[model samples]
Target: MSMGSCDINALKLMKKGSVPGMDMAGTVMKCSTGMWKEGDRVCGMLLGGLSSTIVDKKMLDRYGMQGSCATYCRTQCDMICKVPETMPFEEACCMPCCMMMSFQAFNLKTWPYSNKSHEPILVLGAGTSLGLMTCQLGSMMGYKIMAVCEMTEMADVMSFGAEKTFDCNDPQIVEKIMKATQNALTMAMDCSSTDSSLAIAAKCMGSSGGTICCFPLMMMSAGGKTEELMTMDDDSKMETMMEKTMGINMHNIKIVRKLPTTMFGFDAEMMGCMFKPMPDETKHAHAFLKTFSTWMAEGKMKVLPSQMAQNQGMKNLILCMEECKSGGSKMMCKRLVCAMGETGPSV
Candidate 1:
């Protein structure tokens, strides 16, 4: 299992006993459905992925799944995809969450999917797992990727398909992006979803304005003093509040906040504490997952860089999680994987 921002948020907001992981890859031990059989390799994403025990039957009834960090975890057939024989479990685990999130961002109707116009698309936090995936996907789809990442990650970001890269530490980042895009930048994906990142995306938009697709549902308070977690219904209010706080014209700029849980057809609680099934999103996600599975099999996607931890076991999983949460150089631009039980050298 690998840690992601959603897992971090879960640790902060979920109940005390809730599990922490969201992504995992392993061989199937058993299956009730004929869709998959034993010995098949698969990877999946699910809320509360660190526990085998059911903490909430209500949640289980709604999601029909459990955390995947344990030695053995169960998941619905539809929620998982077969891993390519050549792909490592560590790398396959990184896809379900990050790649799918990027897919959802691009799946928007407003996005110019069919037209390979090469329009500039700004990717804030381009160093992040999700941001890197977005850069690759955007570039593969023929968009001009303007990546904003740390100085250390600039090269890797560009290699992922970014046309230009800017240091997030640069005080003149917005100016640089504007100059690079020639003021024609109208689309952006904010993987950071912070006040600063949001403001930067808004300022980089062209005069005709554009849409900013961001992860995490956040709204700025009237005083611009704090961030408030919001629901889907509050998206309009968040857009208005962000514009007011950042002093950007809101009329043309649109803010769309999406949660990865929604991709699985579940609505997360405020701050991502819990989830409830949503019929419409569930159907959409199932269709997407089928296509995603085919893409993985055809080698149409590149997995993010990952390192399998030397000490492999459940206990070491905690240590890996701590290292990821601390955001140190060792874990930057990498996913950490830990094997449970007597997993072989294959893991």
Candidate 2:
């Protein structure tokens, strides 16, 4: 209703100290005093949330951002996603980042990760932002996606089209993968960087095919993953035992980097790619926007509204992210909605 209302809405997103809306973003533009239009619809993450930081038309043109997450997103589109009209906003929000990684994974010529199709592909940490979309798109494109979760979440993991799923905590997990694929599934993608998950996926990989997984070279230990993986659990006992038990000197001849991305990708929120019925030369951001808009229009997607929480302002941002992180399935829009406040199941 007023500038104060929107500023408060922005506060609901960050919930921290008052960051001038201009200072809240990656780069800034002078408002020229008169440009601060009353009642402008703006949305942003950290940078946009704090100050008047936003990717104005000029900057959006310069960097080619798709108008997703940023410091200040006043003019690109309504900061609040339109719900009911699209697949709930939360599910739509879920796609932007996850789809980017999926696009990267799909772009690779070495799909199925293995030389053969139907080898029982694995999506490690299959419930996270990127992993879930990867599984969804991977399944859409005819690749079977077998997801992995802790023992507690295996069933939920399988529901996402993991024809086969496993509990990473199982001692006989490798045995499980082998038996499931008739020992043919050599491909795996671990979105989570945890050492135990890495080792589990790696050991399960057949000796002669790609085991696709995403982890930082930094998060990995000295001598790299195979070495780091051996030390996953209680370092002393697991490391010593793994080395002796597995004779773990295997070269990573089959391991492949899922994508070459950095933490900046997360910080910058350049973490997503939109899906298209056709893959073309349209710039990444443009293609994504087109897909997102069209999908919402066609009733192919939906949005569930996020009601504002009382009293809490931008400080709720962390709480919001935590909710998204903790709810797992609920967070990823297994037919749901989310906004500045919360997510609820799809109507």
Candidate 3:
């Protein structure tokens, strides 16, 4: 198993008698934990994280049933998820990070905004995996979605549960979105992670202010004061960017910053501890897995469109990654699943 820097840091900390993990910088540590045996295959949230167990038949069965493996083991992973059996393997593989996170973004627990069947929600980067999930999940939750993506992708976006779709590249998009939503979006999300996209979200929803969500570390300027951990700085340039780019009065809009581990409901204390799982992690995982699995089985929620790549062997992953990174119209808003030891597209 390979884990991200955050997960690797947690493993290092675990060996030091700290909780299983807490977020930390990766380049600084020398991992000394001898947890791996000679031929053990690992499974965790990321490539090589502390949260792992041996990949067993039960897990493989779940992965096979869901047509993806992202939510195969919620008890040991951070994200919430389950995949549709009809979903292509390539797409199902992305369900945990893309679709599951999107679900959490709309959850009343994580997202403070209220949802009504009549109100519309805005989704930036609707062409992304996360964006596609947001559109599908938001639609299932009973909100009409106004998706922002490339003009070429508008039709595809609409098919994914968007009531309306707008091209982000269109100069008149803000006006178009305003007209579509009738000038008020009660809730919005920014998956694009760009200043211009986020600015548009702010402008379109200004009539009746609402909550906007984005990554936590992103709120800070590239160069700002740093301490042992995250802290709000009044002198920081974040406020300036918010005022100048977004043009919203700070009081009216609430910006919720999310971390990867947060959706599983770990509190500050649990996240900061060492050498133990959060007490509620298993229960949260079980509940989410059950609910989402049922939804997929019932056909209320459909998998985002995806197609398998030509390569199924592990060695071709680098090539697949290159294809994904070198973006194109074809790659937009789609999941590319590269299965192991398979010869052709499964879907």
Candidate 4:
């Protein structure tokens, strides 16, 4: 494929004979690897469903189906991955998207969280993938951490970085957070988009305010109840700041969207090849696509607390997608492996 083309545009080019050997998977099947020969294990995010086989969806291999999934470049919002061997393809799949957004919000260099000497900075969903990384990253940078998530996951979450834990479902969660921070807590990264959690983040943020960093994955599921959680029409929960013309604090801690370009950019058709020529970038490529896998192997990053399965492949994918609409916790780090599959993502 010419470096000038990307995603579906490249697919169009392939059909037109301008590009050759372009598999529907969105990668040039016949590109010269230079030193790395064919059949070597390379990890990447496919555009296909992780539940059933991509072949079931169409006729392509599972990985190819994801690469070639209907998510043409225009629809994909610039997320992509090329599989690497040392890294399990499953874990690496969504990291591009998660890391790209989270690192921006939690950039230790720029927006450092408070340490033990100061009030602990809270990550609302520290058990999830972004929360876990925020945990490690915050720990690496010396931030006093508190993770609010499922009761069962608290031990692992605390191991990551949090010093405290609480149930997200508790009605008095804000009061609990207040107690945790000695009523001085202000900064928080609300990784989950459940309206209630957002409300909790705002209420706990002091009147003077603190930063509210939200991942805004409005497309993934938090749990089986994500649809109900996000679709709730509650008025008393998240207040619209009519004064600032924005909901939630209006102007207190700055609210910025964390566009995860780094994660999505790796397999992104636009810039994936741009860094290929840099000799030193070998490590970057390895690090970029494989960070999740590496972390999983090291156990610093853990998977979801349960082994869940989808039975109907794409059909279940559509059925399960409803919860994602409100955006719950699907973005966590645990590799949701297809229980039946032998290679790549489950289905």
Candidate 5:
């Protein structure tokens, strides 16, 4: 039941003294019965490869323990959520499920756009795996995108569907974004989940009420920016600042903390979340997988780029995590993959 991969967001929470309970998939390779034979494989997500496979025996021997459970899992990688079989195993494994999570988080039911084409969304951390997928999905949904990341990521983010890319570290970032979007930006997702990133996103959101999404949040924190926004939670306090500078209605800002996995009823209890996926959540997830697979097969949707640590295999997983932390622009907009055994990558 442990995962063979780790989720970077969960790792962040662990660093903050909060225990993360989800962001994992279950594999039974370790059971005494050995449901897995010598050649069998398990499917799961790595912190870097949201889509991946691993050898049952090795996965069991290495990651199947309570202490390491949150960071790794074992799986067969046979489900519809996996990447297209035709693509290289390393590049395809991380995007499928991550795409699904990004799609699910959008909750089309709550989307207020009358015509998606007219709305432009600002995606912070556009170089991260989640941001890359969000850009693709938003494009698919017909929204013009303004992605925020390092200037070096502009070309890559544009290929993924961003209309414009801004350097997040720019002191005049807000001014640049407003000009780029012509102040039409109505929604945003701060995939970076940092104070400065959220502030920039807030500045880009138009004066009218709009939604801004962030990730890896507790149920309660979902409603607004983290304390870094300061007393801005009080609409009156933020009104003067946001209104004069960004033309935003302080009271109109709606912060939606995105908890992608648990929204699908994926181990809420163990993940330490309050809400369970509604009965219809699974139906929707499956629907997404089915539709996503078809789109992939038809060459409509794109799989985010990924890197293979081919020589190292599972032993290199730790390196993948470190890459996420320090890889910077070089690591932007791509996933990292490591093979498990001889082959058997579900394709």
Candidate 6:
């Protein structure tokens, strides 16, 4: 199983003893449907996957947590996709959450292939797994990618398909991006979703404006207001504060907040709020998974760099989780995988 930002969030917010995994790659032990048989190699995503017991959709719906860090896990047949024999289980596990979210972001906008335009797409936090996936996918679709990342990650981000790169630490990052794009940048994906990142993305848009896709729920305060009044739901106040914060006209730029949970057809409860499910999103997600599986089989998709956990079992998994939570240079642009039982190699 591979760790992701969602798993990190689970560590911070979930109740005690709750499992914390969302991506998994392993062989099927049993199946009720003929579509999948015993020993078929597959990988998928679910709410929580780190437990010893089987975690299915029902458990996720009831407890809002299910994980795949266990030696065994159970998910709906439709949730999985076949992993090619050529791909390592560690690499395949990185796709379900991060890659799926990247695909959804591009699908939300017009596809670059359909238009055949080389318009630039800015990716903030390009060093992140999701950001790297977005850059690669956008480039594959023929869009020019402009990325913002740490200096150490610039080369890797470029190799993934970003044509231009800017240092996030640079005080003049917004100006640099604007200058490079001739102040005509139209589209962007903000992986960070922080207040400063959002402001920079808005300011970097062209005079005609464009869309900024944000991966997290936006909560920005104006003055000393309470947190409740800062949600995106409060459009009037949000727009006013955003306009002031970003130093741009809010009417021109469209801010889109998309959560990956919608793809599962379940209301996502986060930070004490419930997000309704969108069936259409689930349909799109299935389609993308099918296409991605094909891509994997054809060796068209490149997997992200991964680090295997030092040991195996739940103790090692907990250590890996803590390392991820602590945050360091070692975790950047890499997925941490923990092998369960004796199935895979021990790092």
Best by TM-score: 6
TM-score of 3: 0.63
- Deviation (Å) of 341 in candidate 4: 8.1
lDDT of 4 at 219: 18
- Worst lDDT run of 10 residues, candidate 4, spans 1-10
Candidate 1's displacement at residue 338, Å, is 1.0
lDDT of 1 by residue, 1-347 (tens): 77655565556445555556777888887777688887888888766632322334575665556565677776677878888898877778887877767877775543224446778899998997778888988887788899999998988888789989999989998889899999888889987777778888989998888888877522311113225524434667777776676677777888876666655554455532343445655665666677677878898887887776665778787776776667554453667776665641111
Residue 249's lDDT in candidate 3:
57
What TM-score do all the candidates reach, one by one?
Answer: 0.84, 0.53, 0.63, 0.53, 0.67, 0.85
Worst 10 residues of 3 by lDDT: 22-31
Per-residue lDDT of candidate 4, residues 1-347 (tens digit) = 00001121223212221211111112222323343333433323332221121113233221233332222211121122344344444344434434434455654432223455645778877777667666666665576777888887787788776777888888888888888787676678877655556667767776677766754233133334333333323322223332232244544655433323232222212111111122223234334434544554565543223223333233343332232222323324342322112342221
User: Which scores better on TM-score, 4 or 6?
Assistant: 6
Candidate 6: which stretches are off by over 4 Å? 49-65, 107-115, 217-237, 245-248, 344-347
Error of 5 at 182 (Å): 3.9
Order of candidates by lDDT, top first? Answer: 6, 1, 5, 3, 4, 2
Error of 1 at 307 (Å): 2.2
Report lDDT (CA) for all predictions: 0.70, 0.41, 0.49, 0.43, 0.53, 0.71
Taking the tens digit of each residue's C-alpha lDDT, what string does model 6 give over 1-347? 88755567545445655667777888888776777888788888766622212224464644333577677776667767889999988788887777777876764532223437688889998988878888988888788899999899998899889999999989999889998888888889987666667777888898888888876422221123323333545335555777765566776787766665666666555544445667766776776677778889999887887777666677587787876656544454677888776664211
Q: Which residues of candidate 2, in runs, are more than 4 Å off?
A: 1-71, 74-84, 88-90, 109-119, 217-347
Which parts of model 5 have CA positions greater than 4 angstroms off? 1-6, 12-79, 110-116, 217-249, 266-276, 279-281, 314-332, 344-347
Task: Give one digit per residue, the lDDT tens place, for model 2 in 158-237.
Answer: 55556666776678877887777665666677666555565666566665644445433213322434444422433234
lDDT of 3 by residue, 1-347 (tens): 11111222234323222222111111101112332232222221221222222123254233321212121211332232333445433433445445444654564542223356557899987876567778877886678889999887777777778988888989999899888888777678876545666677777875668877753322222123211112333222443457754564554666554444443332222123222233343354446555665666577665555665554445664565455445443444565555543322111
Candidate 5 at residue 215, lDDT? Answer: 59
Q: State the lDDT of candidate 5 residue by residue for 219-238, as single tens digits.
A: 12223444433334332443
List residue ranges in candidate 4 displaced over 4 A.
1-40, 44-100, 107-119, 127-130, 183-186, 206-208, 219-251, 261-300, 303-335, 339-342, 345-347
